[model samples]
Target: MHIQLVRHATLRVAYKGRTLLVDPMLSLAGELPATVNTPNQRPNPGVELPMPAEEVLGGVDAILITHTHTDHLDEAAVKQLPKHLPIFCQPPDREKLQNHGFEQVIVVESEYVWEGIQLYRTGGRHGTGEIGEKMGPVSGFVLQAEGEPTLYLAGDTIWCEEVEHALKSHRPDVIVPFAGAAHFLVGDPITMTKEDIVQLAQAAPGSQVFVAHMEVWNHCLLSRDELREHLTNNHLSERVQVPQDGEKIEYKR
Candidate 1:
């Protein structure tokens, strides 16, 4: 199995004679607004899509969407993708994905099995408590292919009880989390903090935790180097990884 990180939460997963694109946000700089209902604004700065959405995504057998946020699912990606491609998403995003022309849209219940991959839907909180109300409910996906390692894709969420439940239930070999620590002028922190990540590693002992979603947006304040150092100091460096944009990593059993 080959997993390549393609900026933000976007990724290209190639396995079992198929390529799946997850959370593809392709747009030019200044093309869209930043945060919803906020005066804070900035340029999109564009995405480094592997190829044109129409070209590469045609070969995609499936699309796994974590959420419907613009940063994860852009208008450009929606317009260009083939209508025939099957879309797998949580209940909240099913209607939106189907409305966008995808004929086969499956709303994940407990687990959704496709080909040899078993995907489990786990609950997620957008922020701490009150802040989550503004951000909306979210979910993470735990993916496991026959003989391949299990992966837990922690969507836009903070470290909460639900996340801990997923970790204990799925026991993923790799935990891919959004670690940008995003915040607006109002709330506290919406995303996972560096301390939270360290706690995550400690909670799921022996699991390799991979961090992403940093530095791309101005609101995300955490840095990659700082996270690395924290992990190192905690004697958990080998168990955690922070990949750069376009970088690829594989897990072998």
Candidate 2:
């Protein structure tokens, strides 16, 4: 299996002879405005796409969206992706994608199968307290296919009971956690902080944890250096990988 960090929250994954694009935020750097109610108000997408947009989208068999947030599925992606491509998303986002003119919007309610890949929808809390409640519903996904390693993509969530449950139930071979410690001014981090990441690693010692959603947006406070440093301090660096933008990591099952 292969996974490429295509920028913040966006991932290009290859497994079971199929390529999937997850949460594609394809806008050029500075093309979008900053995230509101955050510390840094600088234009979003602090850096450019490491490769050309075409190259990033090339040979994608399907698209998987965790939610309808602009950062996850932006205007650029809506414009670039082919209308005929099958899109897998939660039920809440079905109407939104249909409104955007996508022809195939498959809602993964609990579980769904496409070709040889099996997708299982899981729950997540975007934040805590009122902020989390207001952030609305979010989801994570588990992918399994014959001759391929099980993969768990924990989308836009902190370390919570739901995540722990997924870890215990799925026992994934690889785990991707969105770890930026992103927050607004009033609330605690809306994404996984360093401590949360550590807890996750400890929870599932056997799974390889890959960090994503860092340093690209104004709201995300945790940088790659900081996360790596924390992991090194905790003696969990060897188990976790923090890839740079457009960097691809390969794994054998």
Candidate 3:
């Protein structure tokens, strides 16, 4: 499988003979406003896309949306993506995508199969307390295909019971966790922190962990350098990979 980090949580994954784009935020840097109630109110997407948006999306076959958050699925994405292409998302987002003129919106409630790939939906908590509640429903996915390694895409979530359960149940060979320690002015981080990544590496000792969702937005406080340093200090540098924007990594069974 080939996975390319397109910036922040967006990924271009080529697996099982299909190219799936995950969480596409296609706007140019600073096109969007800053996230409210957080430090560093600079315009969102602090950096530009490693390549042009069209080039990044050139060969994609489908889209997998973990949630409908603007940072994950933005206005540019809605305008740019082909309406006829299949879009797989959680239940709550089905109508929203349809409303946006998406033609084929598939809701992966628990498990779904499409063109030989198995997609299993899993739960997640975007945050805690009222913020988490306000963040609303979110999901992750476990993807499996013949002759390929199992992959777990842990969506926007912190270290929670649901995430631990997904790790235990799927035992994925490749794990991608959205990490940035993204938080607001008055709450714990909504996304995985460096400490959470360490815990995840320990739990899934055999799985290769790749970190994403860092250094793109103002709310995401954790930088790639900081995360790499933390991993080295914790003796997990070999197990966890912090990929730069547009960097692609290949995995084999």
List all candidate RMSDs to the true structure.
Answer: 2.2, 0.6, 0.6
Cα shift from native, residue 167, model 1 (Å): 0.7
**Candidate 2 residue runs with Cα over 4 Å from true position:** none
lDDT-based ranking, best first? 3, 2, 1
For model 3 the local lDDT of residue 218 reads 90
Error of 3 at 231 (Å): 0.5
Candidate 2's residue-wise lDDT over 87-162, tens digit each?
A: 9999999999999999999999999999989999999999999999999999999999888989999999999999
Please provide, for model 1 over 84-129, each residue's C-alpha lDDT reduced to its tens digit, 9 standing for 90 to 100. 7778888877777877888999889889888888889998888875
Q: Which ten residues in a row have the lowest lDDT in candidate 3?
A: 51-60
How many residue pairs collide in each prediction?
0, 0, 0
What lDDT does each candidate get? 0.80, 0.94, 0.95
Least accurate stretch of 10 residues (summed lDDT) in model 2?
244-253
CA deviation > 4 Å runs, candidate 1: 36-40, 46-58
